[model samples]
Target: MYPKVGSPKKVTMKWLDKAFAPLKDYLDAHHPENAKAIMGWMTYKGNFDDLYCYENRMTQGYIEFDRSGQLIRCSDNALDHEYELGYERIPVKTESIHPNVDRWIDRTVSAKKADIFREELRLFLQHVWGPMANYDFSDLKANYPLQGSGSPYCLYVYPSRFSKMIAFQFVGDEIVEKNCSLREYQKFEKSEREFMYQGWHLVTLIREFLAFEPDLSTTREVVRKGCEWADMRIDENTEFVLTAEARRMLEELEKEESKK
Candidate 1:
């Protein structure tokens, strides 16, 4: 049949280990490859009242084990959610088939895939942003404010100011690596119309270009083109308006040009 909560007891790591020990040993001995893949371990937590009270409420945790019986990753949600009754374990009905055992296996596989995705995304961000260890950033946006073409892209603005903005484009769900490009804000606006007509989903707009030390020449060229485009737009159209920050950046560019 199914397991039932027999009694409530204070949950602890020791209790979780004691409960999952048999399952861990079984998986390690029989499914060594799967155990090693998921980074197995056991965890537990107790439920207690906010006002210095203790309630004997707990829930079973998920665990994974390697062939050598080493722990990898484990977690329990007992203290996070109410379990109605408490934690209890059903005796393994069959050595080869059981719902509880199957559930943990599924969880382990899912966790492994999730970890892989996280690591990939982390490396992708680092490659695109390039050693962001020193930059102060704010006004972050991820998968929101859908573009007019109904596509969402990630954005990260630095220094909490509108002085510079970086837009990231993605192909499907994966980021396009080493593909940073820059275009004037006005030119980008014009291009968006073309993109919308052509059904293109990704676009990057560079309003103000910030120089990176030990710079990549290609990135600098793109930023330079953006600045040149903005300068042409300003000179050709008296009606074109610039944001306050944009205006300041343009003036600074003018001063730098005069010095050269």
Candidate 2:
């Protein structure tokens, strides 16, 4: 067995909390309105007793608004498993990280909270890209994309007013289109979301970005298309994956600090 690294919660929390502080600090300072939650994960490097296990190295991959309410912070000990066509998924024995490194929380609640955050980014892209809006996401889907779960929230797009770039808010199955000027949209909703819906495993750090010139290429690529299944990957490499990048930057900082 691998050497114990404190408890799972303690070890994971130390890095997870600080993995995105600088970026988050900038966001809260400038764009408190667009404050966002960053979710990330890092697996043990290579095989056990190797680089990461010998000297902890952090990997970065994050998706904003992973789910509507609960953003699952996942850490998979990929060293123990392999992906084969017939490989059986080994069932974990406990909720503890030592025996079971995989962690996720799927709480059933309103997805509307994340729907608004999702729309904010969508609207921004729609306005800036204009004719080139679909360059990134053509449509928005609920974070938890399950049908008939009593969470009757559907993500529908608004026809562009191109006349004035405005962001609309959803209200009881209707869009509040009239008084939702872009300026007001940007200013309001200051309290839309936080990093933790309710913390578990000490994952409680937050971030918000005011301004950054982003390059939105290679966010998602069509990989291996079968009749009905296609593989899609999202990580810091993907476009608009800010949270992942945030954690990565923090880890880079940690590496630098350690050398000192």
Candidate 3:
């Protein structure tokens, strides 16, 4: 499905070596078999890729590559590993043809910041939702705030499941918002809650902190002690007040009843 490998060109061993450097390092460390098995595909007569794409997910090659140089043609289901069956496996390029005019930024992350995204988010959630709360973030999706599509985790309470205490269907016109350090009853109508933009604002702050430093001091007052996601709704036309203290009392009462 790539543009017919329309205009293929050759790339140097140096360029190829540079482009795949990170993968080479990883494969060198971990994947000895795949490191040896991977092959370079070329168009007929020693030409490298002209245009490219990869994955049915279609996440890469979204925009046009440099139209003037070496590229790869990526077909649908390229992950299936069948594209090379009929293509020519040419020898590696020996000469540099065109100068890489644009500035090439290295995409490698420093070892200190590597692979800490999910862990940092987990810490943030635990600080807000309490140590006992259970959450499922397997479907969690996030984007840079105010820039891209915005993270889905910041849009809805469902796709990324918080425990039942914080995530549930609104059944009535009003719910008591409790344990958020309010001196009096805090009521939020369903319509008002819909517009609260609760998740959006929360995610924006988290994103800003992540992009700069991991310091979460700005959010210290908002989400501590299960307040961020805890809102008890009215039940059977009656207001339910289940603050953290009330839940603790209920637990003690249950234990006493069990003993009796």
Query: Model 3, residue 186: displacement in angstroms?
Result: 29
TM-score of 1: 0.22
Candidate 1 lDDT score relative to the true structure: 0.34
Model 1 steric clash pairs: 40-64, 41-64
lDDT of 2: 0.27
Each candidate: what lDDT? 0.34, 0.27, 0.32
**Residue 187, candidate 3: alpha-carbon lDDT:** 24
Residue-by-residue lDDT tens digits, candidate 3, 1-260: 22233221333455444434433444366556655443222111111344332222222212122224223343433222123324333322213211111110012222332232333343334443222333333433232222333221222222233332233221111111111111111222332344344432232233333222224443444444334555433235555669999999999999999999
**Tens-place lDDT digits, model 1, residues 1-260:** 11211123343455444434534465577667665332222221221121111111233444433333444333443123323424333321212322332332234324443343333223223322333422212233333233443221223112212233323332222112211121222233453455345433333522111222223334445543543343121222235668999999999999999999
**Angstrom error at residue 155, model 1:** 8.7
* Count of backbone collisions within predicted model 3: 3
C-alpha TM-scores of all predictions: 0.22, 0.20, 0.22
* lDDT by residue for model 2 (1-260), tens: 12222223222445433333433443466446644522111222222121122111232332111112122232343111222435333322222221111110012113545434443333233332332434433232223221222212223222232222121222322113212222333322221221012210111111111012121211111110110131233334455536988989989999999999
How are the candidates ranked when ordered by lDDT, highest leading?
1, 3, 2
Lowest lDDT 10-residue stretch of candidate 2: 199-208
Overall local distance difference test of candidate 3: 0.32
Task: Output the worst ten-in-a-row residue range by lDDT, candidate 1.
Answer: 47-56
Better of 2 and 3 by TM-score: 3
What TM-score does candidate 3 get on C-alpha atoms?
0.22
